[model samples]
Target: MASDLLIAQPDEGPVLDLAGDLSLVLPSDFPRIVKPFAIEAHSRMLWSELKQPLTPWLLMLGFEDVDPKPPWLLPGLRDLQALLWLAEQLDHKINSSGDGVVTVVLPPATQALAMLQLARQGPELLDSLWDPLLTWWTETRRKLSHFDRMLRLQLPAADALRPPEVWRRRLQTLSTCLNNPAHSELVLALIGDAARWPVLRRRCALMPLNSLPLSRIVLQGQGWTMIPLSDSGLPILITARDGLDQRDAIRQWWGSASTPPPSVHWGRGDQQGRLTLTCRVFAPGVEKADLRITCRDQKLEISALEQRLHIPLPEECHGFTPLSARVKGVCIEIEFR
Candidate 1:
């Protein structure tokens, strides 16, 4: 049996968010992992690159003991690399499309930059209001293509005495008016800039709409929506609108797991031999991962499919090595000499 935990960066778009997840194993049968065991667990990651602290434990566990005969180098279950490669190829296709044209989707960061430009150009909006204004824009705008179109709407200087919330709501209203310029009466009521409203409406209407529906990006008041496309410019539906897509995405991100050297220990109860691997996720929401185990002793081999392997030892299964457990891309191998 395995227990899992998730920790992750916030999902808001900055684009530079760290993308990879590292799983930390904290195997325990008790209510919580003991401290020394936990510390040793974190030190297992190659990213940690810490070996001095693990040397003593390595000596004690003797997990590295293996036959001196030429060690067999087998193919790895490298799903993590495949997923990352898929993501990179997708990004390249996105960036290379339309002859390196810029997207119309005004990310929150880009909106802030636009506001700063407006400040320099003598717009009444203050410097401090950029974040709040962009947040309001992001939350209220539902359409994907028309998403960044709201940024073109000019904001009037807000009263310094009023609360920040007032400014956000006011900006939302102004954005609504800008997005619906055909309703002149509504625009007049929401946006006080009578002189600028007509000009904004004309400019927004003239701006070219070149992005195809297949390639267009949108934020649906939650997060950026990803609609993958085929080469023929048709949207390739990967999954339904149900939350399964989210759950699977979380699983892939968190599934590549690593573990410290495992060793034998006393059983919890008489004859109740069990192995519990506690996997902690760097990003939250993933509760499950597939595990495949392969154990071999020179031509006498046994393989446990991801679902078939479990902790409580099955009777007739004497220990065998080298043993390997794979979680997505992570392949933890323990071979005895």
Candidate 2:
């Protein structure tokens, strides 16, 4: 059978030899048909391997070998152009939808520019011009609309807002559109500003809230008492007292403990009906962390480093404390404490 006789020689670049076919012809004729078939099969395999999203540039480079006069070259070029066009469309859609617009638009624009450069060097050059131009026009319109919105919104801007660098080469289009230097600079400035605004806004938003001086304080709920500790005169000290939920109290007191403490031995106290809590204000980041606690009928304040905190239980009290505390973005712990 032909299948049994066909042998592929790897070292010879995929040569397939057929012995059974064309017995009437000389042995040299065997190579004529088999070698071409092997080369075609190899080329098809290579093309299949090249058809990956990450390898478009490599595939484009391989297209350098494609004959400009070949019937297949035009269709293949059209397909590649279609892929690039689709990518451009998807990129615009993503940019319009608040996706990473800068990342989406800039790299593809650069790649299109490079492809255009390569195409200009080749025989069928004009065919290369249409795809990049379409992409550029579509992207530029979207960018301009975005910049207009940013200017209206008083948003910060970046550098890409002007007519694309590629526009200069299209003098006919530029002349028809009346491209003046003043107009060009203004558009460019707006595009640049718009591109940079989001990053700047994000940085500003992530900053810590402004610190404020402590003023007058008051107890907001019943069954809760606020006590003022000895103020160091520089920092403030305050405490609150309420009926204790043991789990909540421990959670509030030791929420920062990465591991369980050896034991939390508490001293017995008289139910003077008042649970006295002590909170000593430490310097921000140095002292015990702040805790904000709210019960059904009371609120309490406790510190992070304090070993013992007094929580008063009132007769007929029906409430539990919910504690929450945040240290900027570094840590936010909410349990009982």
Candidate 3:
């Protein structure tokens, strides 16, 4: 998200000084109705959702016009780096950070809040000092205090003694950068392949792989399921176990196989310039009641009650537009022309 820098700083006295101390004052009617899964894991769901809004707000106040790189690019770069690391774990040749680590490059929440506090307290000093501090760290990865002292040596007596309190606050804010999570730790948490790394089991939380911008490509007859991690479109393959498809294995492990899998088939329709596709619905009452079909780019996503299927459209169907889709008996017929 793009944010405009605050031209005239707010005169409000002593805003929240730390990220942990900040709490969003949401309306009383917030989340009036909750989904079943969110209701069961309310705290986790809230944390996941709140992070989206909170991060942007803190970033606006802290970095604003000072960031050399756009803040939004930080997350995408982290995701891409994590993807390369995942490819490496799957025995694919993908380079990531040289050291096989993907660090969160964005400022941590606590540090961002402190920077905002400091910016409000003394925006004047930051214009001259912040860039050099960032440049020194990027080159030498040295402590900020080292930069602080080195800078103080060159400063004239009168300029350096302007405000003792402001100097102290600057050091405190810059110090929080040291508290950022380790690169390896953050990447491992995102990949979530605990089976390969026993150390990951010790961690309390793991990000769901599906949430990342990744796509699973099954290699038929090769006994492997390839997950494409980058825009290169080449697949990073993982050997399948016990002759079971990776998704089927997941379903069995999760004990959610009550619903029969949807069967799909496509062929040339009765009319010339038309294609017809059909999917068998096991539970007509459930699937037909609140069914939704969405086609975007080259993929079709069908969702109903407790089942979802994502099917990639054939190359031949690219130019054909969707004409009609309807449920009949225990089957859904979708026509394109």
Top lDDT prediction, candidate number: 3
Model 1, backbone clash pairs (residues 3+ apart or across chains), number: 7
Number of the top TM-score candidate: 3
lDDT of 3 by residue, 1-337 (tens): 0000011111211211121212233233432211111122333433344354344434534643322222234433322222222222222111222222121222342333333234323324333544565455345433444754876422222222222343334433332322222211111111234243232211211111111111121122232233323221222223333454354333232232122223456766556554554433222223244467788878766665434556678887876666666766434566766
For model 3, give the RMSD to the true fold. Answer: 22.3
10 residues in a row with least lDDT, candidate 1: 183-192
Candidate 1 C-alpha lDDT tens digits along 214-273: 111111112214432112121122222333324344344333322211111112222235
User: TM-scores for all candidates?
Assistant: 0.13, 0.14, 0.23
Per-candidate Cα RMSD to the true structure, in Å, reads 32.1, 30.2, 22.3
Model 2, 1-337: lDDT tens digits are 1121121111112222211123333345334223221234433543443344214333434543432221244444532332233233333443456422111111222233333233223322433554565566556656677775776532222222222333223322322222222211100001112234333222211211111111111121222232222221211112223433233332342222222111111222223664432222222222223343334334233333222222333333324233333432222222331
Which prediction has more favorable TM-score, 2 or 3? 3
Evaluate model 1: give its lDDT: 0.26
lDDT of 2 at 68: 24
**Would you list the C-alpha lDDT of every candidate in the order shown?**
0.26, 0.28, 0.34
Poorly placed runs, candidate 2 (over 4 Å): 1-26, 29-34, 37-40, 54-337
Query: How many clashing pairs in candidate 3?
Result: 0
